[model samples]
Target: MSFAPEELLACALARLIVARPTAHVAVGAASPVPAAACWLAVKRGAPIRLSLLHKRSGNPFTEGSRELFDLTGQGRVDLFFLGGGQIDGQANLNLIGTGEWPGREVRFPGSFGSAFMYMMAGRTILFREEHSPRVLVERVAHVSAPGVSEPGVFRRGHAQALVTGKCVFAFDPARGRFILESVHPGETVESVRAATGFGFDVAAGVGETPAPTEGELALLRGPVRDEMLETYPEFCGRVFGRRAAA
Candidate 1:
């Protein structure tokens, strides 16, 4: 059966979530892809506690991100999703914009709690669909969040993986670099290299990313889509052909 790119990405992310011992997953307000992946993992019986910050109803927090921050500080949030206007090989995020302090050239959404969440969360999965030299850079103009801390610093966790449109990269906190794990269909190592600005190591015998299984496709098209309809109606309609009621 055919599946949209979003569904494929969600399935990939679900696999990553279930691959590890994830007890709780938190998705940010602008992250529809991670939210869908969290729901898919639950539907697949991963026993993961999902916290959708943008849920229209039954939101877990009462006073916005304050409670979320509190939980993250207490190490209750196991996995979180983060993205930036620019990400470097070291996984440092640049949400401050491009050029100059405070990004006088190209302004992006200011970083609110990314540094805290990145340091305190058990692990982070960086997701950015647009994979280009502009988005993936050699170095971020500003460090909104440092992917790896120096010795003697207290860091709860680091980025586990970065999912892009072209491939999946496994991050190595020890070396502070990315390793190409798999290339998506229709992409090759050369293509990914051409698109990326930073250098990375390639996994030996790198292979294609596995397509969504039949079971995964069923859940995404059915229950997963249902759960996302309210929070991500436009995404559901565009990718799953299900529209929310007016």
Candidate 2:
């Protein structure tokens, strides 16, 4: 059965989420895809907890980010999703836009608690639908969150993988570089390399990303859609042909 690209990406992310021991997963703002993936995993009986920070209503945290931060600080959050205006080979994230310190040229949304979460969370999964040389830079102009801290620095975790529109890259924190895991359908290694600015190692015998199973598609279009309708109505409508109530 044919599926939307968002559905494919969501299935891929759900696979990643369930691959490891994820007790509590926290998703931040402007992350409909990751949120959908979390719900998909839960619907599949992955036994994962979700803390969606951008939910419009019925939000888990009454005190907002303060409570979320407290959970993360206590290592209760096993996974989190992050993206940036720029992501480099070293996994440094730059939410502060291009140009000098504080991004005087093109200002992105100010980094609020990202550095803290990046350091405190058990692990992170980076997602960016737009995969291009500009978005994946050789070096970020400013470091909003360093992927790997210095020796002895108190860091709970690092990035696990980066999921882009073109491919999936598994981060190797010890080497401070990404390793090509799999390319999305219709994307080739050469094509991904051409679009990427930073250098990365390619996994041996890397293959195309597996298509979503029929069961996975059913869950995404059904239970997952139901769960996300309120929080991401536009996404649900576009990807699952469902709309939220007025």
Candidate 3:
């Protein structure tokens, strides 16, 4: 079965979820892909708890961010998703945007708990839909959160992988670099290499990211669309069609 690019990416990320031994996942409001992956994991009988900041029902938080922070800091949450306006080979993220500090020429939304969450969360996955050199840079102008902190910094964890539109990169904290894991369909290693601004190690047997299985696609196209409709109606309408009004 065929899936849209976003759906394919979501499925890829869902696979990533399975690759890691996670118990709880907390998805940000703007992260439709990660949210879908969390729901998909549940549908596949993974016995995982999900906390969606915007879900209409089954939202664990009674209030706001305090509980989320508390859970993460305590290491109760196993995984979380983070995005950046810019990410580099070292995994430094610049939610602050490019250009000089104090003020930038193009400023993204200021870092919202990213620095703390990236460290506190047991595993953080950097997810960026755009994978071009413009966003994937050789260096972030300002490091809101360095992927690998200096010794003695109280960081519980850091980024595991970067899932992009083109490929997946596994980060190595020891080596302080990223390793090319898998290239998505229709994208070649050379293409990914050309598009990425930062240098990375490529696995000798780097392979194509597996497509979403028929079962996974069916779930996404059917009940998963309905489940997300409460908090993500527009996304469901665009990606899965609610009531055939597309």
- Report the C-alpha lDDT of model 3 over 1-246, residue by residue, as the tens digit: 667888888888888888889889989744698888888888888889888877767778986768899889899988989999999999998989777884368888888888888999998888999999999999998888889988888888889899999999999998989999999999999999999999999988899999998899888877788788889877888888833564
lDDT of 3: 0.87
Q: What 10-residue stretch in candidate 2 is worst by lDDT? A: 237-246
User: Predictions ranked by lDDT, top down?
Assistant: 2, 1, 3
lDDT of each: 0.90, 0.90, 0.87
Q: What is candidate 2's lDDT per residue for 169-192, written digit by digit as tens?
A: 999999999999999999999999
* Runs in model 1 lying further than 4 Å from the true structure: 242-246
Candidate 2: lDDT of 140? Answer: 90
**TM-score of each model, paired residue for residue:** 0.96, 0.95, 0.95
Instruction: Assess candidate 2 and give its TM-score to the true structure.
Output: 0.95
Better of 1 and 2 by TM-score: 1
